[model samples]
Target chain A: MATTLTREQQRQNTPDRPKPGGRPGAVGGHRNWLAGVAGWLWLVVVVVPIYWIVITSFKEQSSYYITNPFAPPAEPTLGNYGMVIEAGFIGYFVNSLIVTLGAVIPAVLVAFMASYAIVRSRTGWFLRSVNSLFLMGLAIPLQATIIPVYLIIIRLHLYDSLLGMILPSIAFAIPLSVLVLSNFIRDVPKELFESMRMDGATEWATLWRLAFPLTRPAVVTVAIYNALTIWNGFLLPLILTQSPEKRTLPLALWAFQGQYSVNVPAILASVVLTTLPILVLYAIGRRQLLSGLTAGFGK
Target chain B: MSPTATPTTARGSRNGGLAWLAVPALVFFVAFGVVPLVGVLALSFTTWDGIGDINVTGLTSWQAVLSDPGLPHALWVTFLVMALSWAVQTPASLLLGVFLANSQRYRAVLAVVYFVPLLLSSAAIAITYKALLDPNFGLGAGLGIDLLVQDWLGVPELAFGVVIFVVSWQFIPFHSLIYQAGVRQIPKSMYEAAELDGAGRVRQFFSITLPQLKYTVITSSTLMVVGSLTFFDLIFVLTEGGPGDTTRVLALDMYKRGFQANLMGPASVIAVILVLVGLVLALILRRLGGRDATHSQMEGA
Candidate 1:
C-alpha cells in the first residue's frame, strides 16, 4: 500500500518519467496463430450481422427480400428510415435523450462527489463505510429490485414518467460510477491535494478545482459509460413507463419491431438509428471508454 | 477502489467534514437502492395485485411459488443460461483478449470493429437477430441457404440455443475488452523469463500467461455470470420465453408474474431469490479467485 503511493508520488514528481503507457503489449504475439484465426473469425461473425443490418436497412422493402442479405442495397433508399422517423421515432429518441441526459448528469455528479469523499477521506469511518456500501450495492443487481422500485415510483407518483426512469437509473448507475471515479481520484497525487489544502482551499473547492479537473478524463469516461447504459436501458423504461409517449428508444425499438414484424427494413432502420448516437459518442471517446470500460472493476 | 487508499494526513483538518459530499449519493442509493432492497423482501411477504390495497400475508407467496413447478423450471433455465454462457464466453474471451493484447496495428483496427456489437442495445440486438433469423424473409431465404433458414427461435431447444447465442453475440466483445486489458497488464518479463527457460509459445502460455490471468478470469467470469442473471431485455425480445417456456429465465419470470399477471407478491419473492442467488454466486466466484483477489475486489470494490 505504502509502496504504491510513494512510487506514484515519485512518478508525479519526476517530470522526465513519461507517464506509464497502456500496459506493454503482449510478447510472443504472432506465435499464437490460433488466437489470430479465432480473432478474424470472430470479427467476421460480429461484422457480418452489423453489416447486414446497415445494408439491409438501406434496401427497398422488396429489394430487401430479393437481394443477397450480405450484399449492399441494389437501389439504396432512405424509405425505411423515413418510415421509422415518421412513426414517432423522433419522440422516442427525444424521450431517450432526455432520460439519458437527465439521469447521467446527476448520477455522475453525485457519484463524483461521493467518490471524492471516498478517496479524500479514506480512513474516516463514515466515508469508508459509504465506500464499502457502494461496493456491496454492486452485488445487489438493480434488476431484482424492480418490483419494489415500481411500487415506490407509484407511491411517489413518478410512475409512467421520464422522471420515474431517471431516478432509478441514477440510483442503479451509482455503484459502478463511484467505483470508477474513486479509483481515478485516488490516483491524483496526494502531494497535489496537500498543496491545495495548504493554499487554503476548502475541500469542496479543491474537489472542483483540483480533484475534478485532474480526474476529468475519468469523469468523462464514467459519464459516457453511464449514458450508454441508460440510453440503451430497456427494463426500467419497460417496467416504469406505460404510455407510448414515454417510451425510450430501446423499448420503442422492441414495440416497433413487434408492430412491424414483417417490415424487416424498417425494423433494421430503427435498430440502426437506436445505435447511431452511441456509436458517434464511441467514436469521440473510444480511448477513455475502452480504458475505463470495466468501470474500474478490473483495477 | 485500491483498498489501500490511506487517509490523507493533511494537518488541521483530517476531519470528517467531507462526509456530506457523500450524503447526496447515499440518500439516493438508500431511497432507491437500499430501501428497495429491504422493500423487495417486505413486499414478498405481502399480497398486492400491483394496484389494489396491500394486505399482509404470511408465507403465502412463498408457499405458492414453492409449489409451482414453473418456479423450478425457471430457476433451472436461469442456471442453464448462466452456466452455458459462462462456459462459452470465458475461453473465447480469454483467447481473444490475449490476441488483441498484441501491439499489431491491424489488431487495434480489429478491436474497433469487434466493439460495434457492444454499443447496440440488447433490444436492438435481439431485433436484429430476430429479423436475421426470420425463416421467410431473413438472410437464409435471401441467400437461398437452406441451412441458415432454420426456425432458430421456434423450437424449444433451438430457442434456448438462440438465446445463448444472441447473448454471446452481444456480450463477448465486452468481455474480450476486459480480457485484453487483463492480458496487457501481464508483465512482459514473465514471458521473457519463460522463453529463457526454453519454453515454446504454447509452453509459455500454459506456464506463465494462463496462471497470471487468474484474477482476470475470475473478474470477467463473475461479471458475465452475474450479469447474465438479469438478462431480461434480450431474451424477452428474442423469444419471449417462447416455444413453450424454454427461454423463460428468472428475470422474465419475475416480470411476467408481477407486471403481466398482476401477481406482485410472488414476483417480489422471485426478485428476492434473484438477489440472493446473485450475492451467493458473487461470493463463490470471489472465493474461487482466492483470498487476495477476494479481499482486493470485494473489499476494495
Candidate 2:
C-alpha cells in the first residue's frame, strides 16, 4: 500500500517533460530562506517563555516587578526555590515519583505480556476481541470516566491516596502501551518463535528469553512514554486526592498559584522546578520518546 | 526437524496456557477501565448524590443537561476552541513541519526547541502563561507592546482567545511532530522530480506535500478536536473558566456538577456526552480520511 502511494506521488510530481531554464537553485534558495526564517521565529516563540520561566524563577520578588521581564536578573536569588521547597515541594516531588514509578512499571510490564499474547495468538476469537477491547479504549476519554472512577476509588477506600491515581493511570496507559508494543512485537520474525519452541522452550521461557529481549527498545519506549504521561497527569490527582501532602507536582503547581497570589516569581519558581525533571528526561530520551509517540501514526 | 514437529503440536496445547499471561492486564482493564465506563453510563440515568441511595430518574438528568443554559454556552465555548485549534494550529504546524523536514542544518536542534512546550506539564505551561500574560509585569509589557498590556485573563471578550492561543501554542509542536514524520516519509525523488518539472516550492507544496499529508492532517485534526473537547487543566489553572465562564468547557462543567454541585447524575450525563462526541468525531474523521490510514491497519492487525 505504501509503495503504491509513493509511486503515485512520483507520477504526479513528475511532469510530462522538463521545462527550460527551471532556475531550481533560485527556488530552492528562496524556500530554504523561508524555512530558516520560520524556524527561527518558532524558536523564539517556544524558547522565550521557557527562558522567561527559568530567569523569572531566579529573580527576587521586588526585582521581578522592578526590572524588565525579559532581562536577566541583576540580583538573582534562590529565595523562591527555598520558599517552594519549604512549602512541601519535596513531598509533592516524592508523590509524583511514587505515582509515576508505581503506575508506569506495572503498566508496561502487563502491557508487554499482553501484547506478546495478542500478537502470537492472533487467530483466537477471544484474543481478537481482547485486541478490539484495547483499541476501543483509545476512544474512552478520561474526562468521561472521572465520575465513576471517583466512586470506585471511594468504594475501595483508596481515595485521597496515591494508589487511587496510580490504578486508573495504569489502566489508561495500557491501551496505547499495548498498541505500540504489539506493533513492535509483530515485527519480530515467526521463525524465532518457532525455533525457540522447537528447542523445547515453554511459552513462559520463550517470552522471557525471546520476545522480552527482542522487544527491549519498545519496552523502554513504552516505559518512558507512560512515565511522562503519569508524571504530568493532573486530573487524576485533582479528583482523587484531597490532602495537600498527597499532591503531585502538577497539583503542587496549582496550589502554588493560589497561595502565592501576586507572588509571580514564587509561582514561576515552582513551575520551573516542576518542569525541570521532565525536561531532563526529555533531553535524555527525546529520540525514543518521539519515535514511540509517532510509531502508532506512522504505521 | 522431527523435534520441531513434535514441539509444534505441544505449542498448540500450550497456547491456552500462554493466554493466561494476559490475565493481569485484562483484570486491571476490567476493574478500572471497563467497570467505570459501564458504571458511568448506568449512573447517567439516575439522580443520586454521591453518598445517598441510588434512585433511577429516567432522562431527568439528561433533560436537565439539555435544558441548562450553562451547558449550551459551555458547548459553544468548546466548539469555538476546537475550531480555533483546527484552523490555527493545524496549518501552522503543517507549515512548520514542512520547513523542518526540508531543512538540512539545525534540524534536530530546531525540532527539540519546538517540542519544549509539549514536554512540560499543562499546569506548568498554564502557570507560565498566566504570569507571562500579566498586563503589567509580563514579557509583552517588558517588550513595550502596548496592545498586550491589557488584562488577558481577566477580560471576558479576550479571555477565551488567550486560552485558545495558549492551548494552541502548547499543542502546535505535537501536531508539527506528527506532520514532520509524515513529510519525512515522502520520497525525496518525488520532490526532485517536481523541481525537474519546473514546479516551484509553492507549487510542489500544493501538489505533492499537501496531498501526501491528507491522512496525517485527518489524524491530527481528530486528536485536536477530541483534546479540545476534554481540555481542563490548563484552562482550569489559567482562567478557571472565568471572567464569567467564558472559557468554561464541558469537562469543567462536568467537574463542577459532580464535585461542586454534588449532582452526580448530570455529571455522568455530561461525561457520556463527552465520550460519545469523541467517538463520533473520531469515526467521522476516519471515514473522511478515506479509511485506509491507521484505523484499518489497527483492525487488520
Candidate 3:
C-alpha cells in the first residue's frame, strides 16, 4: 500500500500528500493495540477491590477461612446479608437517612439565604465579618473541635440521639455549601435580579423566584457533596451514638466488626450492605457530580 | 422593587433587612459552632474530668503535655505521616494523571480505578486492610509478604506508615481527578507545536504540561497538606494511637486528653494548635495561589 501510494504521489503534484501505509503504520497500530490492553488492565485494577468486597459478601464463613482468598466462592450464600439485616441494619440505615436529610435541608436553606444576603447586600462590615467567620471554618479542622464537640453533645444530653449527630454535621457542612453557592449566585445574571426588583418583588421574593432557581445546579452539587460527607461520616456517629438503634451505616459496620471479629463473611457482607446506600446515591447523582466537577474546575 | 433608595431608608432596611435572614443562622452557628469552639478553648485552660463540675486548672495539661515523654514522638509521627503522604501521593497522582490524560483509550477506566477508593468509607477500607494485613490467615502469608505486613494497628512506626498509606490511598483518586481536569484544558495547539518542534513526550510534558498545570499543582498540594494535617477518621479507626501512643496525631492526642483522659484544657490547647496550623496553611496557600487570580476562579468549588 505504501509503495502504491508513493508511486501515485510521484505521479501527482500534491506536495503535502505522503505515502499512506507501511511498517511505520503497523508500529503505530501496535501502540494503539497495546494501549487498549493497558486501558483494560487499569480498569481491572480499579474494579478488583470493589469486586472483592462484593464477592466476599456472598461467600460463606468456610470459604473465607480456608479457601483461596482471591478465588470466587463455589457456592455463594445469602447468610451474611441475612445476618446483617437481621442485626437491625434497617434501623441504622433509617437513622442515617433521616439525620442526613434533617441536617442538609436546613443547612442548605440557611446557606442559600446567607449567601444571597452577602452577594446582594453591597459591601458592609457585617457581611464581611460573616463571610470571614465562615471562612475561618476552613481553618478550624473538625479534629481540633472533636473534644469540644463531644463535650457539647454530652452537656446537651444529645449523646445517644440522632439530633446530636445531625446538628454538627449541618454546621460543618454549612461553610463550604455557602462558599460554593455564593460563588454560583454571584455568577447569576444581574438582569434577572433587576427585572425581579422592577416587578415589585421583595428581596426575599426575588431571592426565591430568581436566585434559587438559577442556582439549581450548584445547589444539587452541594447537596450531593454534603450527602456523601454526612452518609460516610464515622466520627460524629461513633462518638455520639452509643446504641445500635441510632448508629449510622459506617458506625454500624464498625460495630459489626467489633462483635463478629473473625467472621470474615459477615464483616464483608455488612460492608457491602453498608456501602449500598452511598453507592446508590452516587450512581443516581453521578451526572450531577460530573457537572459539578466540570463547573467547579473547568472554568 | 426600586434600585434607588435614600441612604437613611437603605440604612433602616439594612438594620431590619438582616434581622429576618440572619437571626436563625446566627443562633444556629452561635449555639452549635461558636459556643463549642470557645468552650473548648476555655476547657483547654482548665482541668475537667468531663463529669461533676468545671474548674480552671490553668495550663496544667499543657505543662503535662510539654513535660511528657510521649508528646514529642507523637507529634513527630504525625508530622512524618503527613509529610510522607504528600511526598508519595503527589508524584504518584501526577504521573497517573499524565498517563491518563495522554492515553485516551485508558482514561475513563484508569480514572475509575484510581477513584474507587474515594467512594468507600474510610472505616470500611481501614477494617478491610486490617484483616488483609493480618499476619496469620490473611493474604500476607499467601503472597509471601507477611514480613512486610505489620500489625499495623499494634506496631509503632508501622502504625503511622499504615495510616498515612490508607489516607493517601483515599486521596490519590481525588488529586488525580483534579490533575486530569487541568491537563485536559491544555489546548491541543500547544502540544501540536511542541510535536512540530520535534519535542519528545517527556520534553513536552516538562516544557508545556507542568507549566500549564501550575494552578492544579498548587491546589492539589495545598489540599493534600490541609487534608493530611487534619486527618482523623482513618487514623482513629485503624490505629487508635495504639502500641504506646506512637501513632497519636495532634487530633488523636487532643481527643485522648480531652475526652479519654478528661484533660479538657490540654486537649483544647491541641485543638487550638490544630486550628492555627490550618489557618497558617490556608494563609500560605492563599499567598501562593494569590498571584494567580484565575487559579481560584478556575477552582470554583
Candidate 1 per-residue lDDT, tens place, A1-299, comes to 44653453343232332325644444442246678788988988998898888988999898777677888887899999999999898999999999999999999999999999888765788888888888899877789999888989999999899999999999999998898888788888999998877776677778889999998877887887888889889999998988999999999999999899999999999999878888887788787776555555554
State the C-alpha lDDT per candidate.
Answer: 0.83, 0.80, 0.71
**What TM-score goes with each of the models?**
0.93, 0.91, 0.87
Best by TM-score: 1
**Model 3 CAPRI rating:** acceptable
> List-wise, what DockQ does each model earn?
0.39, 0.34, 0.27
| Stretches of candidate 1 exceeding 4 Å from the true structure | A1-23, B1-14, B292-301
lDDT of 2: 0.80
Off-target runs (Cα >4 Å) in candidate 2 are A1-34, A293-296, B1-12, B140-145, B292-301
lDDT per residue as tens, model 2, A1-299: 44653453444334333423452111121143455566778888888888888888899998887788888999889999999999999999999999999999999999988998899886666667878888888866866898888899999999999999999999999988888888889989999998987788867777778999998988887788788878888899999988899999999888888878688889888988888887787778787877555545543
Interface RMSD of 2: 6.1
At residue B246, give the lDDT of candidate 2.
91
Q: How does the DockQ of candidate 3 come out?
A: 0.27
RMSD of each candidate relative to the true structure = 6.6, 6.4, 6.8
Off by over 4 Å in 3: A1-45, A290-299, B1-19, B102-106, B142-153, B291-301
Alpha carbon lDDT at A22, candidate 1: 43
Per-model clash counts, in order, read 0, 0, 2
Which of 2 and 3 is ahead in TM-score? 2
